[model samples]
Target: MNVAIIDYGSGNLRSAAKAFERAVAEAGLDIAVAVTSDPEAVRRADRVVLPGVGAFGDCIKGLNALSGMREAMEEAVHGAGRPFLGICVGMQLMASKGREHGEHRGLGWIDGEVVPITPADPALKVPHMGWNELDFTPGRHPLLDGLEPGAHAYFVHSYHFVCADPAQSLASVSYGEALTAVIGRGNMVGTQFHPEKSQATGLAVLTNFLRWKP
Candidate 1:
């Protein structure tokens, strides 16, 4: 199988590519991983991953700048039903809208809004950096196969997705209050943390994604 990690000039592509490579090796699959901005490459991929960093509006702008990239993504992920994953700001882009610097539109794949994190305790900070535990939903999700409840993942973001339907949230993290950590709807899934930097827990997540059927 071929997996394409869409390079929209916003994220750490090398790190994410390497992690997927390791996942393929560990899973003993003959999958090919490519980091490309080419829409044709994405169209031919069996699985698609969107990884982004930086401001929400900026990431969206960069993605739109690429010729045919957005259309290719919609066709492959939305129309073709290919397994899809989005990480960090990539995940935020799935929301209906983002309230980062100003009001910004997103992919609207998920019915939600990206808003700044507000900790119930003032001592907690924004950008919610460092490691945090994942609290999976009761039935959990296929993308979280090998990961257990309380498994920690690396996070570094000022804003988080606030899903309109609570059922769309697959997992969450507690930072004074519960923050959305994982989201999934049908064949698409997203994570607010960097699986590449998350150690064993992260590796397992990547591995699971590589082997996931839907």
Candidate 2:
């Protein structure tokens, strides 16, 4: 199988690539993972992963700056129905709009908006760094195949995706208030945390993604 991790000049491509490599090896899958900005490469891949770091507007600008990369992603994931995964800021880009650094347009793959996390407690943090528990929603999602409700995932973000439809939320985390942790729609899934840095829990997520069908 071929997995293409889009490199639109925003994320830690090396780390994500290495994580997928380790996941594939452990899963015993014959998979070729490529980190590329080439639109055509992404279109041909069986699975697509978009990983991003930094601000939402900046990430979207980077992706749009790449000629045809955005179109390629839309065609591959939206038109062809390929399994797609987004990590951290990458996941936020799936929202219709983001409130970070003013309102910015996103991929609109999911019906939601990205907003800054406002913890109810005054002492709570904004980035929500470190590890947090993942509380999976009822029913099974292919991406959560080997993951349990209390599995902790590494997170480092100030903004989170607030899904418009409750059914789109696959899991959530509590930090003074409940926050969306995972969102899924059909073959597409996204995580607010950095799976590459989440250790075993993250690796299991990547492994499940490699084996996921829909």
Candidate 3:
């Protein structure tokens, strides 16, 4: 099977690709992982991964600039029922709209909005960087397989997704307050943290994604 990591002029393509490769090796799967910009390649992939870093508006702009890329992704993930994973700003794009810098439209895969994080504690920072322990119900989602509550994952973001339906949230982390960490609905799943940079925990997530049927 082939897993396509779409390169939409955002995210660290090399690092993300390397992480997926490592996950494939650990899982002992003969899967092809390709970092592609071609819409056809993304549409044909068995699994599609969208990784992004930077402002929400800019990222969405870049994605829309690519002719038929969004449509291809929609067809593959929604129409074909393929498993789709989004990372960081890639995850934010799944919301109905993002209120970063200005109003920006999203893919609307999940019923949510991307808004700036406001820590409950006054001492906490805007960009919730470094490793944070995840808070999740065990066995709720396939992506969190083997990862119990308190499993650490790397994070670096100023904004977080707020699900209108809390059921869509797979997991969350405490950064002064509860912040959305993982989101999943049907065949789509997303992580606010960068799995590529989260070391062992991240690798486990990627491995689970590779073998995930839903």
Candidate 4:
């Protein structure tokens, strides 16, 4: 199987590609992982991964700059039912809009908006960085198959996803207030944290994602 890790000129492409490569090997899978900006490559892949590590507006701008990239992703994931994963700001792009710098349109894959994380406590900081434990239903989703309720994942973001439907929120983390950690619907799934940087928990999720059918 072919897994396309889209290179939108925004995310940690090399690191993410390496993580997926390791996951594929560890999982004993025959998937070919490609880091490409080619839209056709995405269209032909069995699975698609979108990773981002930057401001929401900047990331979206980079994505839009790639001709046919969004449409190809839409065809592969939405039209063809292929499993899709979004990481960091890539996940945020699945929302209806992002409120960073200014209002920006998103892929609208999930019913949500990307807003700044406002912790109720003054002690908590913006750009909620570092490792945090996840709160999720262990068996609710296949992606979390081996992940426990409090699995720690690396997160670094000032913004968070606010889901319109709670059911779409597969997991969350507390940074003075509850922030979205994972979101999913149908063949699409997203992680607010960097699974590539989360070490064991990250690898486990990546492995599960490799083995995931939906």
Best model number under lDDT: 3
> What are the TM-scores, per candidate, against the unseen true structure?
0.98, 0.98, 0.99, 0.98
Clashes of 4: 0
Q: Each prediction's Cα lDDT score?
A: 0.92, 0.92, 0.96, 0.93
- Error of model 2, residue 182, in angstroms: 0.5
Query: Which ten residues in a row are the worst by lDDT in model 3?
Result: 118-127
Q: Residue by residue across 1-214, what tens digits does model 1's lDDT show?
A: 8999999899999999999999899879999999999999998889999999999999999999999999999999988999999999999999999999999999999999999998888899886999999998545787888677989899999999999999999999998889999999998999999999998988888888888887
What's the distance in Å from true for residue 80, model 3? Answer: 0.4
Supply the TM-score for candidate 3.
0.99
lDDT value, residue 186 of candidate 2? 95
Error of 1 at 201 (Å): 0.9
lDDT measured at residue 104 in model 3 versus the true structure, 0 to 100:
95
lDDT for model 1, please.
Answer: 0.92
RMSD of each: 0.9, 0.9, 0.6, 0.7
For model 2, the stretches where C-alpha displacement exceeds 4 angstroms are: none
